[model samples]
Target: MKYQVGQRITGVINKITDLGIFVTLPKNKFGLIHHKDFGANWLHERQNYHSGQAIRVVVIHNYRGKISLSKMRVNDSQLIDQTNDFLETKKENFLSVLAETVSNSQTEIKKLEQELVIYAT
Candidate 1:
């Protein structure tokens, strides 16, 4: 029922229009995949997205009480690989940044402690 951005979801195509494709998600929830999210190949082909065609999509946006989905990001091979690499890189980079911040904080704390000792004496 409750959907979050970047969450992968499965649904059936309920309607297709020039603007976008409407998907029927679980619990009768509806979402839309805009023309921009259909990807180049699918758009180039101009294939009719028939009703009941099951699709997997990622929740790209949720705003003003509307849910927007992206089929391109979920299904694009390059994007998928890039997404994985990006996440891994972020995870790997987090530790280094955190360590640097912690080290700096410790150094500052030690300096303040030394100043406190001098002031006390």
Candidate 2:
């Protein structure tokens, strides 16, 4: 079975090199999972991968006989999760600031009311 770009495929690690890991795709096509594309949290390319390990990868490039894969899609999911967490924290901060402003306004109003009574007496 031939794989195309944007297609997800399951393959086995056939070899590991400084550049990338070579996966044996169906029908003998070789796919490369590049070291740079392994995401920010990934450490030790060889330790992250091993011979005969099975992985699901998304194909990013297919040029002539050369095929490239990305575990980055999986990594991107983590980034998205982190982004969502940050957004939530920002939202909470905004709400807290708004509450503090309102509280300050209420305190000012009470102070003004006390001053008016003293002036009228």
Model 2 stretches astray by more than 4 angstroms: 39-45, 74-121
| Candidate 2 Cα RMSD after full superposition onto the native fold (Å) | 19.2
Candidate 2 residue pairs in backbone clash: none
lDDT for each residue of candidate 2 in 4-120, tens digit (9 for 90 to 100): 566767889999887878999888788998888865544655687789999888777788888988876744443233222234556549878778879999999999999999999
Angstrom error of the Cα, residue 117, model 1: value is 79
Report lDDT per candidate.
0.78, 0.76
What does candidate 2 score on TM? 0.55
User: For candidate 1, what's the RMSD?
Assistant: 15.0
Q: Count clashes in each candidate, considering only residues at least 3 apart in sequence or on different chains.
A: 0, 0
TM-score of each model, paired residue for residue: 0.56, 0.55
User: Every model's Cα RMSD, please?
Assistant: 15.0, 19.2
Model 1: per-residue Cα lDDT over 6-28, one tens digit each: 77788999988878888998888
What is the lDDT for 89 in model 2? 54
